[model samples]
Target: MYQKIIKESNENKIFQYLFKSKENFVINDIANALNMSFPTVKRVVDILVKKNIIVERDKIGEGVGRKARVYGFNPDFCYSIGIRITSHSFQFILINGYCEIKKEKLYNIELDTSSIVDSLEECINNFIATLNVDEKKHLIGVGIATRGIVNNEKNFVEFSNTDSFPLRSLESIRKKLGVPVLIENESNLAVISESILGLGQKLNHFVCLTLSDSISCSTFQKEQHDSFSFKAGRIHHMNINPDGNLCECGSKGCLGSYISDKALILEFKKFFPEINDFDEIFSEKYLETNFGKLLINNYIKHLAIGIRNLLFFSNPEKLIITGKICKYKNIIKPELLKAIYTPNHIFYRGEDTILFSKFNEQTGILGAAIFPIVDSLF
Candidate 1:
């Protein structure tokens, strides 16, 4: 059993190295890079080749010794389903071994948050049923990225930004779907997605701040991440103001209460009773008014406060801002950075200190999709 574990570990390292570099490597080079024995590397390479996860693509160092066979990752060996559950939709993506999206579906039906477990199962099973027979056979697992404190080991969510409270066991969904299932906080998943697929690539330390229905923060360091830590990365309730508005978490002056979409909408409804929905705040007719100016200004002010606190604590290599609010990044950038800026850090170089994703709407699902691929490897 110990030997098997070591072999699997070596296989994982070699595979990840090849996959990340997107380069062809021979057994000797892989062994040398990974500090594994040549025999072990050869064994793992053979297994991966047999499993159709990698292939001999070319020859290298033709004159140095004998021509060494080079191998590269095979993207289509298997695929996984990734889902992000929002209040109104089940966002889905099918990603191949290479983490390239193959198919995407947005189930627009409203979720019955009171029965999220049943709704989730129905959405997943129904999505899987739409796949072709070949695709179904190649499906490896399902990954869920949710906006909440998720205990993946226990497969239950502690709390969600949506009305989902005390989520039921996901093991039931796994059994019914008849496939492996992994769940992660959408914030962490978004950071992971950025690390693997976006501007955060090759970065060991960074923070992802997502401003959606509520605010969320996820940090990545060189150290191992414990996805089930429960309390890890839960910064939405931090007290940034002592005399500010109240939050649903029963706290006054919570950071999330200042800039979350729901917060903005609630505040807007005070002046215009019929006003609801964060999207409506962007209408040109409304945004050109004095109320819009005040709201946007307040959002930038509080956003800076939250960001300053985050940077002071984590001091990450970069700060990635993603979510629906990012659509207005340009409008907010000037004021937002000014409030968070200092001579030494935060935004010393202005916009360079912050990175924004081009694919705002899909960040959560993309990260969720990559979770299954990461789970399969490690």
Candidate 2:
């Protein structure tokens, strides 16, 4: 029993090291970095190669003691499906083990359009049917990203703002598909994706502030036994003022009343009243106007305050900002950072403790896909 435990521990360390690696390595490299003996690294590498999780990419060196084989993590060893659910649409992505999106599709949907649960199940099963032979063979599971609070214990959504979104536990779908099914908040999923595949890969703690069409935030804390937990997507509704503007949640002074999609649209329409592009909220034409100036100043102020609170409370190694707001990173991200910058503060002085996700649009589903991969392997 003792020997089996140690063997499994070694296998886990080696597999995770390879999965998180961006470059292929030789046996010496793995042994040195992981502080394992050369022989032990070779044994684990051979095991992973046999499982098809790692593959021989090339050989390195010559003329010395013979060429050394280079091993690469093979993402194509398995696959998963990620689904993002919204009141207006369902977004889907198929990803391999590496978490790179291989396929994407969007379907316009609404609660009033049909029985939300039935339609979604049918859609997912239909999507599965379209996979090729190898894809179906390697597919591991499905992950659903939703705004609702997921009750994984019961396999149903317990709370949702839409009130009519899919409330049925996806366990039935899991049975039909013959693979595991999981659900998580979209913001939590985004943070999970970052932990597994993005800047937070090596970090034990972090926070992700997600800005899709809506605003939400979640924190990541790696627990013992290789488990992960996230909480507080409702951070958007944290009241910043007691007497400020009304939020859609029927509360005044909520942070969402100031910076959420509806707030931005309501504020922008007061001036432009014309059709608006989300990017234009930061456009030169918009910001130069008096109303835009006030709007931006307020946005920067509250954004900084919210971020500062998150930093101090969570004390994460890094803070990841994900959303369409990043498209204006050139203007918004810098200014927000500057607002929070303090002369004596170490984190803000130059280190990239705060970071932006590369592609805001993709992380939700990508994160959704990675949840199951983490569940199965790690």
Candidate 3:
């Protein structure tokens, strides 16, 4: 059984090693690192090279012996499409094997099951028309990130608050697009991106809090005993205040009610009726106002309360905060740290446990693009 597991994991181990390192490696080095025989490593490398997943780069001589050929991943060998669907817009990005965006387009359209499928077909067709024949041949699959519970097994959305978006399977979109489709919750996608490519790369256990149009959290833990674990989005509904504002989930005092984009906008409009967009509320001119300062203070307090609850429950090695709220890192981080570091809450650790997202807005889409590649490897 142990041997079977190792045999099954060999390809994934090799791919992960090559993906993590920036430099090329000879077959011998790969064998040594992976603790596999030289012939076995060479066989795997040869297969990958033939598949265009990796390529032989250059030869380097050691002493007076023959030079050894080094192999490296082929970043442009294939591409994937990543789509982020929200109530107000859809963001489409094309990423190469190296997980870099080659092209991106954003469309502001009201979302429903039928409209999303139609728009996706049109956008994909137009986008593919722009690519050359060689680039077109490299197209592999598509991954979508959205703001709700996704039944990955059925490729359907279970429920969502995006106005009038239907609860339906994605088979229609899959047939129209003619590619493998993967759908995941936006917050889960963000955490996956962080775990593989962002601040959580070195952490085996961490919590990600995303403050976007809504607020959500994802906790990642390396399996211990394999007992069933709670899913990530459940943390979004954690109760923070008993008599606080009512939430769309039909609950009062939920954390999301205090920190979501809609909540912040409502708070801002109460002070400045002239404010038209959420982006304007974050402007330096607006933030300088007394009302803006009050809003900031309230936001920080609630955000801190939510983070404190997460720390106590999960005890994660790190807590990463992302999304639109992070744009005000300068104002948010200080007050957040101050609130969390109080003597009574010191047991949850200090500022060292916290980190702001590195990828910012692109985190979810990039995660979507890499999903296929990572899934194939593992």
Candidate 4:
């Protein structure tokens, strides 16, 4: 029992070191950091390295004497392929071990059945052609981020309203692509990316609310294991109003029915039918126009109500607002704060802070890049 307990404790210590440190450590450094014997630490390192989770760095300096090699997560051992397929465009990126974009491509494509797989293949082939032979072999897997109900387990998408094709057959694309693939609902992927590297980094629990015309939420709960991995995506489609308009998802009074980008655009068009382009509808010069201010104010009101409904069950440390709606944060900060503070439950300290995504529009791409970097660490 004591031996097993000691082994578990050592494993925990190793995890703690990896979680907190920015730089890599050799066996001796780990031993010193953990205040354990060198041989014991070396045994732990050997186990982790054998798991292909951590990597031993090459020895430096020419020496006849014993060389103590540096060791850390391999920055070149794995790569994560991240693909973000949205209504307006599709983005694909190849991330290297260091969580950097080694190669990337973005283009708009028609969301159709025949075109979907072809587009994905073309994007992958084009991106792969740019890489030399050695880099091609290091690809660990591909991750697909798309809108609608995605089956994470089978890498199948159950449905997508963006197009009339069978996107649910993404597994076939994976087999053709010749790599393991992970299909994540886009909103959930967004939250995962944020939880790992964005505003949600420090918080263990939080809800990422996509404030675009397509409103959705992704929640993250850090699983308490030997490491820092977490469970993500418990989306609840709560109705914002019973008498509200119908949503694209075929629900009435859904939050998306009131505050989705389409809803906002429809609201604005009704007021200013002459404005067709987004730039004109939300132009800086147009803010002085009565219609512009009204649109902005109305948007904030609906947003506040939507947010209030989210906070009903969750007491997240922070509420991260992303997508196009974040553009209005500066314009509606005062009112947004007021709405969040209106409720005064005993548990609701009203300390819920709001922040914009630092990575902003590039969150999906960057997050895709991080998957490989994180895999290297694990």
Could you say which candidate leads in TM-score?
2
TM-score of 4: 0.75
lDDT of each: 0.75, 0.76, 0.75, 0.65
Q: What is the TM-score of each candidate against the true structure?
A: 0.80, 0.87, 0.87, 0.75
Per-candidate RMSD, Å: 4.9, 4.1, 3.9, 5.9
Reference-based lDDT, residue 57, model 4: 79
Q: How close to the true structure is residue 131 of candidate 3, measured as C-alpha lDDT?
A: 74
What is residue 31's positional error in candidate 4, in angstroms?
A: 4.9
Q: Taking the candidates one at a time, how many backbone clashes does each contain?
A: 0, 1, 0, 2
Deviation in Å, model 2, residue 280 alpha carbon: 3.6
lDDT of 4 by residue, 1-378 (tens): 000111246765775466445367777777877789998888877887886657877775466987778888655656777887776667888776556677777877776655677777777777667776657777777777665565444544544454344444556767875766665555666666786667887776777776543555766666554233333332324676777777776767777766666677787788778766544656776667887788778777777777776777677777887776565556767888786676564446464467777655556556555553444344
Residues 1-378, candidate 2, lDDT per residue (tens digit)?
000111247788888777777478999998898899999989988999899989998788867778989889988899999998876788888988777788878878764424666777877977887788888999999988876566544545634454533445455788888988887888888887787788777777788888655577888876665556777467767888999888777888878677765577678888788837676677788888898888877787887777877787777788888877767777776678777776676553243777988867567788888878777776
Best by lDDT: 2
Q: Write the per-residue lDDT of candidate 1 for residues 92-201, one digit (tens) a residue.
A: 88988777888888888666666777777887888888788767888888888777777545545765544444434677887876778877778877876787778787
- How far residue 185's Cα lies from its native spot in candidate 2, in Å, is 1.1
Worst 10 residues of 1 by lDDT: 1-10
Q: Name the runs in model 3 displaced over 4 angstroms.
A: 1-7, 62-65, 113-115, 152-156, 161-168, 224-230, 346-348
Candidate 3 residue pairs in clash (backbone atoms < 3 Å): none
